[model samples]
Target: MARYAEVVRWPLVEALAAYEHRLREHARRQYELDFIAWCILAQSGATKRKRPPALPTILKEE
Candidate 1:
């Protein structure tokens, strides 16, 4: 629970940071219990996935 702070807190931080090509990549990692719980929660969701509103364009159009 305590260990998932970074992943949950900065879920979209990396994506936003990547546009500048300055994002650092971390090695693949996962927490066992958290992963299992996430899987269960994800499965419990209804069949339809809700689409979020479009994000503002980060980079300028060419």
Candidate 2:
């Protein structure tokens, strides 16, 4: 997992940083919510009791 993290997580972090940098540059309206707030809202909508479908289950059904 550590090896995977170094290869995968580092690129994801860099991509997200680039995305946020572009958003700051091009967005006309400033975001009312910060990153932490957006993360909380994202996870709040995906609670354990109301989770999204599992990838395996969906693939099997298809």
RMSD of each: 13.3, 15.5
| Residue pairs in clash, model 1 | none
| C-alpha TM-scores of all predictions | 0.25, 0.28
Q: Write the per-residue lDDT of candidate 1 for residues 1-62, one digit (tens) a residue.
A: 78567546765867566534432222112233444555666678843434322322332221
Pick out the ten consecutive residues of candidate 2 with the lowest summed lDDT. Answer: 51-60
Give per-residue CA lDDT, model 2, range 1-62, as digits (tens).
78666657667778787766666544323332343455576687845334333333222332
Question: Which prediction has the highest TM-score against the true structure?
Answer: 2
Q: Which ranges of candidate 1 are over 4 A from the true structure? A: 1-30, 46-62
**Model 2 TM-score relative to the real fold:** 0.28
Q: Which stretches of candidate 2 lie over 4 Å from their true place?
A: 1-10, 28-62
Task: Give model 1's TM-score versus the native structure.
Answer: 0.25
- Number of the top lDDT candidate: 2
